[model samples]
Target: MTRISRRHFVVAASAAVACAAARPARAADTVRIGYIGDFNGASLAAVATDQGLWAAQGLQPDLKVFTNGPIQIQAFGSGSLDFGYVGPGALWLPASGRAKVIAINDLGQADRVIAQAGIRTMTELKGKKVGVPEGTSGDMLLRLALRKQGMSVNDVELIRMDPSTVVAAFASGQIDAAGIWYPLVSVIKERAPDMVELAKNADFFPEIAFPTAFVSRNDVADDRSLKVIAVLKKANAFRAANLDASIAVTSKFIGVAADKLATEAANSKFLTTAELEASAADGTAAGWLSTLNAMFKDFGRLPDPLDPKAYFRADLYQAG
Candidate 1:
């Protein structure tokens, strides 16, 4: 049997205790977290699972991991979620209706684009099928890329697919271009070394300094709002402070290679409360919100502009 290091054993033992301690005290009191990215397959979930972030706040999380924001938002609207993460573009659904954004979550620059073999430029995608969840953040980035070249979603065949499915589709020759996040991004690039980066997140929505966050009203009313933030903040802090250890734990929890987590941790940008709020108040962020709303309207995803103010809850960050 392999002897685990003392640090690894300590962290692992602590994780077991934390998982047990984090259980919700009541059904109504449970803070349902709808994570809309590669949650199970990524480092964020590992941080939550191992570092006792949720346990520290007395939160009972109904954690729903997803591959795209639209599916996660659907869960949010149906009254099944308390808090979750979303891309900047998917903010329209909640902004127009009920769910609220509390912060700017992860800003992963390398999590943006991974070009497949045979595609050298955005112009090369004129007649190819590109995979992205329609009306989500990746979708927004895709639109921005197209517009730069005097094109639109109509210019290329858009395949509405979950981010998780993107890699498989590419492997099967179903998609010529894929927009995905870490681990998957790493996989695609490794598989197709000759592919070119058509665009990155910064290249498109430069104003979107980071990804968006959301929480249902029920969580707010239940007094579990601060608990959610506490969990995320603690996990984020742990990730920031102990990158290697966190990566090892995250690798086991997410079931991805440890090397991938190391790569992601090196490239991902996390936000402090001050940093998060500053971006929320940015005129540039507001403009991006407006543009996102317009795109949603044009795509028939939303009927009109969703007020950016309605969705953001800066007080939560301030309190934290």
Candidate 2:
């Protein structure tokens, strides 16, 4: 056996210690997040993850992504996630079933149903198969768009599919149009320019909105929920400050380029913390809840219209 010199021993010991330090820690403050829809802005959440903002705030989230709301909400109910982002219908899931709503994330901007391929407008969709994730905000918004134009779901063929699957349906010509959000929708448009964009979030419905939320077991919010809220606030600030960089980072995660990601980001409305609060309190969210309840009531998604105040937790804003 060779005797190690003092310098060699010191270097070897340092290396061993460094390697041990590099091992993943069992984060005591982990906050697992289940996300879906507008994976564009969810990229902001990704920024928070990559930058360790969650860790800096003494929280860690195991982030999982899905293409629709109800499925992610299922993960939240089944203990796979501690928090989730969902649309209005997700409220019905917990309200109508067994999950719970902790806080409202954002609203007013979600994906839209675009009539592709020389399709001129919503009315042009008559006799055409319009695709949407069944029983989601996208679906609700699509229905509302039809109703607003004095048309009904009967006027068009309804193709119930996951948002992820819509791209393929559109490509295969199985569906005349799709109600999808970006960056998938944007990708479809790029591949098929003949696919006309008949409606977008801004044009289809007047201020119809969805939710990106933080949902968990009822007790998770009892202790460290405020910390989660603060981290989201920091995330919103970071997203506001670094829109371009955020888009580029998102492009990598979504497998798209920076410019294409920017296009989707442009279609979205990024809310400030104060805007989030006001909307949650007395603005679009309040109005949308009333609207959502009425629509759900008609669609049988809800037993009846729920109170707007009952749908959100104002306490989270206060806690933040």
Candidate 3:
């Protein structure tokens, strides 16, 4: 995914805060966001920003696009951002620090692993050289997949490469199998005629883990966060209600053609405002976090366990 910073923008910056709750945008409420460049399922921040929904929540947002989740998560820690989007990996790591999942974005069909023609299944991938970007969702997904097939990362030749380079490597036969996300996965198929899906994220992780959530820095002002949360809810609602426009925005956001995303958009799911808040209170998301943390530890990805209650907050926003 391409990450562009100069294109980062602010909306309705001059709007007054006097009636912020009643109206959108104000000079005083500006929330900087660290957004990862991804498909329609994971690009809600880009979609919402493009739709100017943040302004409707009485806040202006400075959107910094990132190529991956860890760098985006770093923005929140650096205090350069108030909120951001990330996969479960970044949220689970100890380094992320107090960032909590505010909303569950896409549910599935966002990440997968593809193999050369002869390799038809995850089991066939054993002894094969597999490629994944270290520390990214691809890496986590690959790890989960290997475990499911009663294999270990040690069972295959693990090649840590950037997603951008994975396709080329696969084409050159540097790796027999690789975990990747769309439209790169799409591109891999287009370029490598031999590329075939070996496994998808849903094959192992929970829908909760597949979620690309809006996570906020713990220190963000409550009033500002409430307003930003309102925007996130509204934007999520807008996505379901005005999908065509949302897709158009997402296409530009991710620099992909709308037609390709249209197919993927149909496969994705968003955790509604009701669903997110309910999960927060019901301990569903928290439970998933605990399970995910444990899996990360079991896989040797994380050295220690993380507290789900401390990391997940369903109270961040109310339903629209």
Compare the candidates by TM-score and give the number of the best one: 3
Flag the better candidate by lDDT, 1 or 2: 2
lDDT of 3 by residue, 42-151 (tens): 45776677877776776777777766666666776778877777765555653235566666665655678789987888888878889887777777778888877888
Tens-digit lDDT track for model 2 on 181-290? Answer: 76777777766767776555676446455655655555465567677777777777777778887776666665667776676677666777777777656656657556
Candidate 1 lDDT, tens digit per residue, 1-320? 34568778888999999988997645434676766434322455468877666666666566777766666667766777656677666776665765776655666455454457666778878878889866666676677677778888788888888766887787667888866665667777676667666787667435544355555553365346766666666666666667788778866765678887666556566665455556655544455466667767766667876676656665665465
Comparison by TM-score, 1 against 3, better one: 3
Q: Tell me how far the alpha carbon of residue 73 in candidate 1 is from the true structure, in angstroms, after superposition.
A: 1.6
Q: Give the C-alpha miss distance for residue 294 in model 2, angstroms.
A: 2.2
Cα-lDDT of candidate 3:
0.71
Off by over 4 Å in 1: 1-28, 36-45, 111-115, 205-208, 217-222, 277-303
Per-prediction backbone clash count:
0, 5, 2
**C-alpha TM-score for every candidate:** 0.78, 0.81, 0.83
Candidate with more favorable, higher TM-score: 2 or 3? 3
lDDT of 3 at 100: 64
Q: Which ten residues in a row have the lowest lDDT in candidate 1?
A: 36-45
Residue 50 in model 2: lDDT? 60
Off by over 4 Å in 2: 1-27, 37-41, 88-91, 94-103, 108-110, 204-207, 281-284
